[model samples]
Target: MNEHYNRWLHHRGLDPDLMQELLLLSQDEIEDCFYRHLDFGTAGMRGLLGPGINRMNLYTVRRVTEGLARTLIAQGDDTRKRGVAIAYDSRRFSPEFGAEAAGTLASHSVRVYLYPSLRPTPMLSYAVRHLGAAAGIMITASHNPASYNGYKVYGSDGAQMPPHRVDKILQALAGIDELALPSHSLQDGIASGWIKEIGSEVDTAYYNHVLSLSHENNATANQQLKVIFTPLHGTGNRPVRHILGELGFTQVHTVSAQETPDPDFPTVSAPNPEEHDVFTLALTEAEQYTADIVIGTDPDADRLGLYARNPAGNYTAFNGNQIGALLLHYTLERKAAKGELSSQGIVLKSIVTSEMGRSIASSFGVKMEDTLTGFKYIAEKVDRYEALNTPFLFGYEESYGYLLGSFVRDKDAIQAAMMCCEMAAYYKQAQNLTLTEVLEILYQQHGAYIESIFSFTFQGKKGLEKMSTLMDTLRNQPLKQIADLPIAQVKDYRLGIDHLPKANVLKYLCTDNSWVAIRPSGTEPKIKFYISAVADIIDAAQEKKKRMEKDLRDRLETSL
Candidate 1:
């Protein structure tokens, strides 16, 4: 018997059912589950829910909250009094885990303002700042599979707790010796005013702010434009539809099958909108309605996907980079036309996002800045630029995440949906062009830019070791060329540059301006390779991207 496994099984405070389940785990499962505690990366602790320290269960949630509580306590009584805001998405046990976190913080004498039901992540950020809370906790795995759940911590600034604060939280977590300690009673906290349930007030305020971001206030008056939206059984349903309905969008139709919040996500294999396959039900519905455009939000409602009717009259999906480029063009073009474009206006994208946005921003005389791969970094820029008295026009990552307004500190699918819909309505009504057509014009003007991401999932201990070894090999022995393209520049983010924190990421720019980035996903058990290709013609760019993908796969196979 592994000592760690037995220690957990024999712990007196362990849940009896969980202990029995652990007792029955196969040898390999036991090792996989008990080998080590789940690593709390920059994002927070996320893993499969099961009976082990490595999984996301009540105990792990409590431990993380305990760390957060300790960090807040150290910040002083005022910080603790300001408390933390808590919200959850439509995942199994999400509410239970959220309540557990609230109890844990209350046990530490810290106040908690928790959403009464499932809510999107951005609302948690808004609530944190709006309610003057010291921190926020969102219980979600974002777009990960249903088997996974997560706990993401946000700073008082409503961004993901920055690296320095994350370090302090980790320091406090290290001091926690007991993993299965029960938290205080949530009911007791509520009765004593230490835990407050927040609902309609926050929702109304968030809805109003998102509505204010719309450039076309009367966009809903375009009753002729057919629109279809789906929330994929997550938290986006109410807020997204509510905003659209209030905006007077007369022809909005939500995918009825996916409107209800279901943790099982019964209709789709994965709830991620990035995967076109997940939009099967929505597409079918769109075709029936001959919808002008189709929009869908992921499980947490943070990432959005757009499907538009192509020249061939079929619903074609847009990649994250393509979506970002289209939105950037629409926003900047409209703002410039309205004389709202600021001299100090800027757009922010992650390092791996498509350069097409940069081209669009430059055409409008707006500066484009690159941050590390997460939205947290983008949010940091938003906060910084606001303080500097510059306008943050828009921000997006290549993973289908976008933010248009500073009202929310995280990627907001609700806001993206509103803006994308408004843009579509404007183009159709005024320019006599569909969004896809506008995208083609942008591509023609900027040259064709194609981007693709390839990820290799490594599930268990061996997989993790392989991923580490692969990163190490890439870092130590860099590739000079990919498919005969000469490497022009190599940027190793780990060494740090431009005031950004050190990260395990590598990017190689080719002589032809094409680039490929290699990094392990901070939140998932996969190593991701991001490839971007540019050519005068779209066909040429597509061919180059396919060749690059093939070459990358071959190299990874050999290296691993």
Candidate 2:
């Protein structure tokens, strides 16, 4: 640790602010910062912003980017000439980091296409496909706290890079030296044509593609419907609002406080749409506008949160499972009615997602598929569907990520927000129903499917060891029941069951189709417990879900 600290201390290019910060660190802080070198995993690197080998800073970004440059060059001349696309969110140093990545690639003689301003991660995915780039980099942490930032890599297919490719990059990365890395100036890269700035052309192309996904040309009847939208101080403001306006929902109201991009994310505790508290400001605006629905997108606009007016004249937030079920029902029903639905059509979801999606798919005579957690897996299945000439109707996860169609290979909040508005508008005008009412009807048709996620954060080095111990305990001693319901099966993903890739996840399935899944977060310091309970009635389902969560938490606590 001292060796690393001394090396960093003497590095000439270290930023002055970082140098001052490093100079004041206590011994423990220094150890924390230099204990181990940061590992570049398949998800790329994510960490709190700081001046350390283990933190996110210029040295770390350059080191991994240097690896990416080498990997791209090794792919041969054509791939290198195809270049890389770069985009960023409105986070602190996002644009700077993006420019740094571009310069690093250019330094290695790799071509680059870079977005001129902040854009959603989905747009980055779209840009990669639209431009035929070999890979892409997005320089923002999705929904993490203001202190956090990250770099995510995407493949030529516009999805997060698969493990095999990432493994090769890791191998190249291991041989690179951070301080000794070389970089070209962003100015020089552009002057010499090694880097090109891209904006309106890609945005227009992506917008047109998104508009094509709507099921109808007749959104006129619902033009009067009131809607509320918030970007949560991220990048969705323009794209989402533009689509909604183009679709004739001109009465849309933006949460004034969160209308513009703010790197500090000052209005909320955190910028995550998955958290209920993040919706406080939006809900307040919803009531003021008497909005039929309230929508919010995370910092990168990759995840969405929703609320709708209920019959009781109050706003209610639906969990990811419920929202996903609603979207699936709306999409499948519309397609089936129009005779566009095919037997070969499929819906993809994570293994941890609600089985209610499967129930909906079965009713429509379509196949339902399950992948491991990340959107990349869903994207992979989309590739398979294309190879087989089947259609991908929809894909979603309980983390509030949803993708419709194949134009964008990752979860797209802009696409989701548009579809959500279209669905709400159609039902509001034609069916005389609220989103809450439609959700209840779906529950009535399919048995009530209730779900919730419990997340436990374990921080620091010791916390990591403790998390490993917890997973080991769960694997060695299986639970037979929770809340008196017998576990009919245990699916341990680490063993690669169900023909899926090996992952560190354990799912317990009850005979009643109720389930609980345990898995650690790949990018954050937390483990999540997903509980799904089904019953004939919503109240009973809710009660069962609550009891199961309590029992599971108690068991996990004792195990620790």
Candidate 3:
């Protein structure tokens, strides 16, 4: 660790700000930052921006870009010409990091279509497919705090690159041993046409596609629904509002303080839509105007979070599973009503998502499938469905991610925002129902299902070790029962059951249709516990979930 730290400390021509940052870090911080080179994990590369081998900074960014450039070059000239599309969110250093990536790719004679200004991750996915690019680069940390940043690579299909392809990129990245490599300046790349600037044309195209998803008769609901939206000071403001406006949604209200892009994300603690705290400002604004829905999207706009007014006139925040169920039901209902539903159509979700989604799909005679636990897996499934000539009706996860149309392969808040408003409006005008009421009806019809999430974060080296031990213990010394419920089955993903790839995940199926899944987060330093409870009623489900969680905590809490 000291040697790694000294290498950067003494390296000539180091970034000046980085050098100052290096000089000030405490001993523990130094060790934390210098212990290892940042590698591509389940997600793409991400970390706090700083001057360390493991940290996120210009040097690390360039190294990864150079690795990507080499990997692209190896794929042959045709792929290189197809280029890479680059987009960024409103995180600090996002633009600089994006420009640097473009310049790096250009330096290798690879073509680049770089967004002129900040845009969301879904736009990058769309740009990749629309331009027929070989791959795409999204410079963002998603919903992470302002101090962190990330670089995610997408395949030509416009999804996060699968693990096998990412493995090649990592191998190429690991082989890079020097920093003094050929590089082109942003100006040089732009002037030489190696890196072309892209905007309005693509934005207009995207807005049009999302708008096209709206049903013709839904215009009345779109106009009558009063909606409040907050981007949480990221990239969703312009495109989200633009689509809503184009759909005749004139009553949309934007939180003025968060309407513009601010890298600092001053209004929220972490800029994550999943957290209720992030919606504080939007909910406040919703109450002032008596808005029907309060919507919030994260930094890169790939995920969405929402709250809707209930029958009693109080706003309620809905978790990811509830929202996913609602969206799945709404889309299928609209399709069935229009005679657009297909017997071969299927809905995709992560393995850990609520089973209620499957019930919704089954009721409509649509198939529902589960992937491991990432949007990339869902994306892969969508590609397969296309090959088999089946339409993908919808895809979602326990996280606030939903994909309606296949145009943009990754999870898209842009689509979620529009459909959410359309759904709320349609129900409001036709059924005289609030989203809360509709949700209850679905629950009552499709067995009351409840899901609870437990995340224990383990930071740094020791934390990683602890997580490994915990996973190993649970895998080897498996529990046979929980809360006095017999465990019907146990799935250890490390052995790659269910024809899926090997992953460090464990799932327990109980006799009463309840289940629990334990796995470490691919993107963050945390282990997540997903408990899904199913029963004939909400109270029964809640009680079972409470007892199961308590039992699990009793058995495992001491280890941590």
Query: Best to worst by lDDT, what's the order?
Result: 3, 2, 1
Tell me, what's the RMSD of every candidate?
1.3, 1.2, 1.2
- Give all TM-scores, in the order shown: 0.98, 0.98, 0.98
Query: Model 2: per-residue lDDT, tens digit, 358-436?
Result: 9899999999999999888999899888889999899999989999969899999998998888888888888889999
User: Which prediction has more favorable lDDT, 1 or 3?
Assistant: 3
* lDDT tens per residue, model 3, 318-394: 89999999999999998998999998998999989999999999999989988988899999999999999999899
Model 3, runs deviating above 4 Å? none
Model 2, position 254: C-alpha lDDT score: 92
Greater lDDT among 2 and 3 belongs to 3
* Candidate 1 lDDT by residue in tens digits, 357-376: 99999999999999998889
Candidate 2 pairs with clashing backbones? none
Residue 281, candidate 2: C-alpha displacement in angstroms: 1.2
Residue ranges of candidate 1 with Cα displaced over 4 Å: 219-221
**Residue pairs in candidate 3 whose N, alpha carbon or C atoms collide under 3 angstroms:** none
